[model samples]
Target: MERAMGISHFGAAAAACVFMLAQGARAEEAGPHLAIELNAVAPAETGCLISFMARNGHPAAIERAVFETVLIDRAGQVERLTLFDFGDLPAGRPRVRQFSIPGLACDDLGQILINGTSACEAGTLGEAACAEGLDLSSRTDVELIG
Candidate 1:
């Protein structure tokens, strides 16, 4: 009787472990979110050039996405507010967009904030869907926030 109980407990534990692994796999497969990464920053003739790599993990394509972006100075003060239009992001594909801020130096810039979505045009998906599960990352010293 003792040996039978041990085997039964071992089987139940194995089943639970398998179940958890399956759930994790499903979550990875169903990547229902957007990922935005700050690829690079360079100095342009006009000013500071900012490059962003955006990946749409949603099932549908986005016609247009406009984000309310705020540039923060090194002292953590708000520098400027502007609208960055990321046009036509295909589903599961990555897109790169560059913006040049006139009269701003790359070193002086501290952080970039995605205040909110100014506009999002996705078929059957509302504007709020653009920011749904939005993830931000940066490769440079400047921070990227949502």
Candidate 2:
């Protein structure tokens, strides 16, 4: 039993290392390159626990967006969930950020738009590629990475 448990832990660790290394290759970042780290993604609940940080490729202190914890009920219904509104983000322009969620194979964020402006937090990260009527507080749909 002891040997089996050790093997399991070792295998898990190895798998995690490999996965992280693999992800290192395909991180779509924008100009100046802000290190994007996913806090936590829960597709099963149609939400994610996200935290922002600034990166300079060599470990520099940076600022990022303040996202509120979006919640999803067991019934799989989406209401207007607000985490942060027009908060600051880290360096560089905004680009696609990957997430992990279960049961959400794929869903369109539909441009996190508002009105008259497509700049959710333009002052900080410059203009982003989102619609003007998109609700950044809502999770349109996400895909489960499993």
Candidate 3:
């Protein structure tokens, strides 16, 4: 009877471990998100050059991702509002896109705001897929907000 009870306890523990592993895998699969980071900023002859590192964790690829971006000055004033097209973002892939803002100085910039998703083309995934579960970060002095 003692040996039988030990075996039963071992089986129960193994089943619990398996259940926990399955739950963890499902959580990883379900928690898909889009991460956009302000990777770099530099001064161009025309204006400021901004680079963004975008990663798509979704299962489907995003054909086009356009964001309504706002550039804020050091005085906390809106400097410029424009649409930045981040072309195609493949699933599980990272891409870098650079945009040049004419007449804007890199040193004068304070913050970069992703106001909203202007467009997102991901076929059946819909336009909301890109903006939903969006993550934002910055590597430069300029603050990035979504």
Say which candidate scores most in lDDT: 3
Positional deviation of 107 in candidate 3, in angstroms?
0.4
Stretches of model 3 off by over 4 angstroms after superposition: 1-30
Would you list the C-alpha lDDT of every candidate in the order shown? Answer: 0.92, 0.37, 0.94
What is the alpha-carbon lDDT of model 3 when measured against the actual structure?
0.94
- TM-scores for candidates 1 onward, in order: 0.80, 0.28, 0.80
Rank ordering of all candidates by TM-score, starting from the highest: 1, 3, 2
Writing each residue's lDDT as its tens digit, candidate 3 over 1-146 gives 99999999999999999999999997687588789999999999999999999999888999999999999998999998999999999999999999999999999999999999999998878888889888899999999998
Estimate the lDDT of model 2: 0.37
**Per-residue lDDT for 1-146 in model 1, tens only?**
99999999999999999999999997787567778999999999989999999998888899999999999999999999999998989999999999999999999999999999999998876776689888899999999998
lDDT of 2 by residue, 1-146 (tens): 99999999999999999999777665422223333323233334554433222233312222333334343343455433444332443334443444333343233221221123322443433333222122233233332110
Minimum summed lDDT over a 10-residue window in model 2 is located at 109-118
- What CA root-mean-square deviation does each model show from the true structure? 5.7, 11.9, 6.9
Clashing pairs in 3: none
Candidate 1 segments whose C-alpha is farther than 4 A from its true place: 1-31
